[model samples]
Target chain A: MSRASNHQALLAFLDTIRRPDVAAIDLGEHENLVDSGLIDSLAVLQIVLFLETEFGISFAATGVDPGRLYTVSSILDLIDEFG
Target chain B: MFVNLDVGVLHEPLSGRRWEPARLRLEVERRAAHYRQQQLAPGDRVFIGYGNCLEFFADLLSVWQLGATAVPVDARLTPFEIETLVRVARPRLFLHQGELEPSLAPIFEACNVSPLDTDAVPQSEAQVPVSSFTLDDDALILFTSGTTGDPKGVVHTHRSLRARWIALQQALGLESYRRTLCLLPTHFGHGLICNCLYPWLSGQELFILPPFSPQVIMRLGALIDEHEITFMSSVPSVWRLALKTARAPQKGSLKRIACGSAPLTAHLWEQIQAWGGTSEVLNTYGITETGSWVAGTTGGPFEAEDGLIGEPWGAVVAIMKSDDTAIPPGYGEPCATGETGFVWLNTPALMKGYLNRDDLTARAVSQGWFMTGDLGYLDAQGRLHLRGRTREEINKGGMKVYPADIDAVVERFAATRDMCCFGFDDPLYGQNVGVALVLEDTSADTLRELHAWMKHHLAAHQLPVKWYLLDAIPRTSRGKINRDSVAEACAAHEPVDLANMLGAGR
Candidate 1:
């Protein structure tokens, strides 16, 4: 999938998981999800599950740095590299 | 007797730097001198906001060495929250490691703000004499999670801290040569007293990990192998995640593992024993008010009721009615054996009081016993079994419903990953039951099947009037699910039909 489509899919999943009224969160490509209070340690686990199921990619099989999954840009980069 | 404790840190992101304990101690002392040079006198309160790092430990020791109080805030807390706490604490010095948010700068304007760098060599010309403090001098202040209500600062004196360490030593027989692996945040009593202070006082080494995620804790096996970690303690939620993600034990170095902060289920306890490769898995019980852990199950798995918290450790446990009347100390008293009521504890390790909240302190402590606000009972064998929190208990009309009983029953469902049951305000019954579930399968058929199974297991008044399917059950930093928050969240949603969920309750 293209970068735009990937961003759209990611945003949709995040919006679903985050607080209900937080649907209009403005996304900078390189913004940190945790620092912005959009997610937390537990939410990261849910995101990993969402990535695996939605993108058909397994993070366990291909080891990824947990820190790299903390930002929007890095997560998209991970999808490009592994997907 | 002066005890020189050895401290070490496993820096996050795996910096392959070797840490010498003796060198670290000297560095900490130097930092203490630096703080003293900055006019931080004895009995002053110092607020620290650094995460789990060597600098956090150094700053803590520095404050204690000066006979000052250390108030450690959770690094994950918002700047507003931190500012609020700092205002309440009214600390003289605000020592932080990283950059403070712009919002919090105004809050620290009155206090002296100092940037703490662990790697910075301590430079001081004058010889700073260590302040002599009595055992009753206040040492540390930890804020509660504020799950049910507003967070209050729980204060502990040097004497109370030492007493807590002694109680744990008597109960667990902790000693040197046993390295401990700590993943919990040091700000909380469980992490500070039980994991760090107890081990360090016993002259054992600590392998401190950064804030835990399931991904980070999955690497526990490797750390245990490298550090030869023998003793470990964490809340029940982390253990549940570890059982799912972590690799099994590689060696028999793990000796004693304890789970506290929340009740441990029998299934999870058995899994931890099998995967941990240790026979001495203990289910502990305590709160911040009573120091760290006051009671723990040793020798084997809890063979009694699901919430059995085992015997007391160097403390006295008693059961009292709602009206503050103590149950007579006998086998067959009306409120003594096999009857649920408020759990009361009297111990030397109890907190001095809630900071600046004299009314709450007076209400919490009466005579000599600290009211735990926990609903529980003593069995015929005198072992304690926790029901639930007094505030979280569902009063359906006149009959009372305990959430722990429902949680125990619902956790048996294979599809239920995690569950929380709480009480919501209802005009009809005064209070009604609500259940929030983090399920493995969210399909309609699976939920239908689970609900059907739940109906068969729970009684009419005990059945949850509303059900919420959640991605994850919201928990505090210490892994405790705030039942009040869950109930409020359920109340926010469109009300569910109780008759439809639990057909025609009497």
Candidate 2:
């Protein structure tokens, strides 16, 4: 999948995370998912499942890189690399 | 310091003909070769949530053989938490050693595991290639509850975990017992290493059961008798229940009953001793970050002192003051023999660091000691006594609610205000969640409406069972609301005769 297409899918998944409407997540900006308070460890799972089916990639418990998964940019980059 | 405790003694009869370590390695190697054929690499991470004893050990040994790391996720996690961990750890394979419920069926990647799966074959005689590994190698990755903050993955290297097991061997002086029952899940620190791995590695046999229940322990009595079982370790709660409910065993040989993971109340300890099963009741102290058996009471002369966690096991303990300095002469923060502060340990068994969390790794470990967030003191006799944890106070039965979790739901209500919530002590539940509110209206359904909304959005445990309305919550000068004060205010009780509230139950 192209990075642009991956980004689109990522935005939709993030949108469904059940944050308050008042919190108003800006999908185009505030790229740091942790800092933006948009996603936390719980959200990470949904994203992983999405990545597995969408990108045809899998992760193992031992070789997980938190930095690659914690942030949206890094996650997209990881998907691109694995894809 | 002198060696006050005996290091080695066989407390239980042999459970079986002693199984040599070479035989175990051979079995593990066979399993490892099979796993490798399925494309699992030496560095890959896999989740072992299986509750079965054989699969747990074999999968673990397979990981050891492949020079890979195994992360055991507790199967008891609420579905939400399990989903969270699977994503965080990103295990390629999720092994179900126990029965898998339908809820977990959706997310779990299809695997060759599961006893009923036709694809899986038991390797009666298998061999694994020799792999290079060290004590410092990452052996296991376990997660903290994240009760207060985000749960971080704790990573223990082989060296650290093995050193811990060796220290336990020296501390408890374990001999391979004949039939041992494992009640705690493998995901837990105390159960996996202390109860299972440590015993198996020492040529002992382990009998696996689901988490402890009175019925289960009673059934185990027969197995113990059948197998000539000896030593057992379990959480105090399980033993307390077993003592209360189970029929007293007749003509059984259970030597040492060790309890840890939570405080062992003296009342409960005395009850266990009262039962015909006479064994040295040892109270152990350790955490997930510390590779299981860190400090514990020995079978030798031990004072029945309440709160004493005993001295460190083959490790050094330091009590640090609020200023991040070791308290001088051990009086401040309870390190000097009778003072209390934050407890820290320099041990070979400490985990290398939090998995993928360098920031947390740096904060928790400093100058070679892992700073356990638990608050406790060391008496002059060098025994440690824990007071409580430094993290947010939890009232599992009371009103100390997780504000983040509560607020997450309250904000969803149309008429609700963005307000702070906290927990207070409730007589019925240990801790109950109470929210300081600024809602538009106060009708009779206020409580009913709030409860209904929470039920849909929050887990039963996460819901605030009680609600308290406040004009505004107290805030610090820097603009952070002081939750401790809010909680204290909520806790302060007005003397009310029970007759008044219930009206003598008409």
Candidate 3:
């Protein structure tokens, strides 16, 4: 899939996982999900699970930087590097 | 070391504040002097507005020195929730180290409660207030749940607290806890009494930090290595993050570790053991009423098993078929060797009772055996193994939030016709709050208004993350909410998309 399609897929997954008051499409690409109250601090784990299962990004033996999953832009960067 | 009144040096790991025994005593005395200037008398209640710092401990000690009861509140509580608690707590003064919530200004005035700054100490050499508090004097009041309304503050006297400290010393020695780190909040018994106090008051160094700050949990390995921490305790939810994101501590300085305030699965238990480089990870079982840390894996060597809590510490654990508090704790058929039943604990560390709540105290305590709402069994080896909880409280990342509390607030909303709150399992928090509401209208405007009302009344953690709009809240023929059934129904349907309905899309 192209980068646009991948981004759309990421947004859809985030919609299923974020806090009830914020929409994935409304959130900025560079916005911090947790700091902006769009998602819970622990909810970042869901993002990790998503990246690992959907994009085949493995963080088992050596953990990925949590900052990579803090924002949509950073998470997309991580996906490009790993996926 | 357990009997001594002298406490160890206090350290703020983040701020780099250290107070030696002598300096700590002076600070406590200075704060006590300051409190006396404010006419803080014996038996009066003082609310602590901030926690997890050096000043908090000093203020608590000073409050005790003046024979006043110290009530520590979760700083995240909404002003409405705080007002409800303050109405019940009836504190004479509110001591804070941070900016008081501006919204609470009116409530404080109406309640006749003064907010005092912890740093506003007397300049001149004010005489230190004499420590006149008796053993029977109330020492601490931890508001466990019911913040939205019916506040249930667990009140512990100095005697009961000392009983817990002495019991911990006898059961789990103080060597491993020589340099302890507390990443949990100080408002609750598990964190204040067992994790932080049990050792620090026994003359062991304590390194305190903001509870569960991601920055700290992210670099937990380096934090431990830098402080040479020997012991620490946290919930499985926190370990979940550290095990995935943070590097494991390489130093062999850690002697013991504990996971409590929530269930510890064998999977997470092993991961915690590996991450901390310690095999002594204990799955501790405790409740707010029992001064916390009543039982745990303390006795002998054992493999990590799911729901396996080894033995009682400073308490007698009993499993009985009858849960009736009116009957004597022993006046029932004991559960056969491995049969799960109501867990009862007879311990000297039990709280005096809920603050100003004799009815609640009566229901929980009978003949010195406090009924733990947990369903656990005593194995053939006489170890305590937990099964589940019977209470209608949601354990969100180890912070217990009651369903009734949320329901109380939602039911009061003008648009809400009926409401029921329940716990749903989550990958992050072991369980998160979810609600089923029967509103007058299903319009987006009504939901938005209800959302604003909920945000004003409820704490951030107490807000329902998953919402379900229903025609009616399911009830049994007896006219009572069966939360389990309602939650199961919610699971069969997708939760309402508040963001999409409210047009938050670009």
Chain B TM-scores, listed for every candidate in order, come to 0.74, 0.74, 0.97
Clashes of each: 0, 34, 0
Q: What are the TM-scores, per candidate, against the unseen true structure?
A: 0.71, 0.66, 0.94
User: What docking grade applies to model 3?
Assistant: acceptable
Candidates ranked by DockQ: 3, 1, 2
RMSD to truth, every model? 12.3, 18.6, 2.4
* DockQ of each candidate, alpha-carbon based: 0.09, 0.01, 0.38
| B1-506 per-residue lDDT for model 3 (tens digits) | 11234999899888898989888778787888878878889999999988999888888888888889999999888899999999999898998875788888898899989889888776564465667768888989999888887889999999999889888899899999999999999987888999999999889999998987766777788789899999999888888877766777778889999899888989889988888888999998888888899888887899999989988888999898877897746787778889999999999988999988899989889999998888989888999999988877888888888888999999999998998999999877779999999999978888888888999999988989889998888889999889999999888888888767654632
Candidate 2 lDDT, tens digit per residue, B244-282?
A: 334455565777777787666676676665553764767
Ordered from best to worst lDDT, the candidate numbers read 3, 1, 2
lDDT of 3 at B299: 77
Model 2 off-target regions past 4 Å? A1-83, B1-31, B97-127, B130-132, B147-149, B176-178, B217-228, B323-335, B393-506
Better of 1 and 2 by TM-score: 1
DockQ, structure candidate 1:
0.09
Q: In model 3, state the lDDT of residue B273.
A: 86
Residue B54 lDDT in candidate 3: 89
Worst 10 residues of 1 chain B by lDDT: B497-506
Best by TM-score: 3
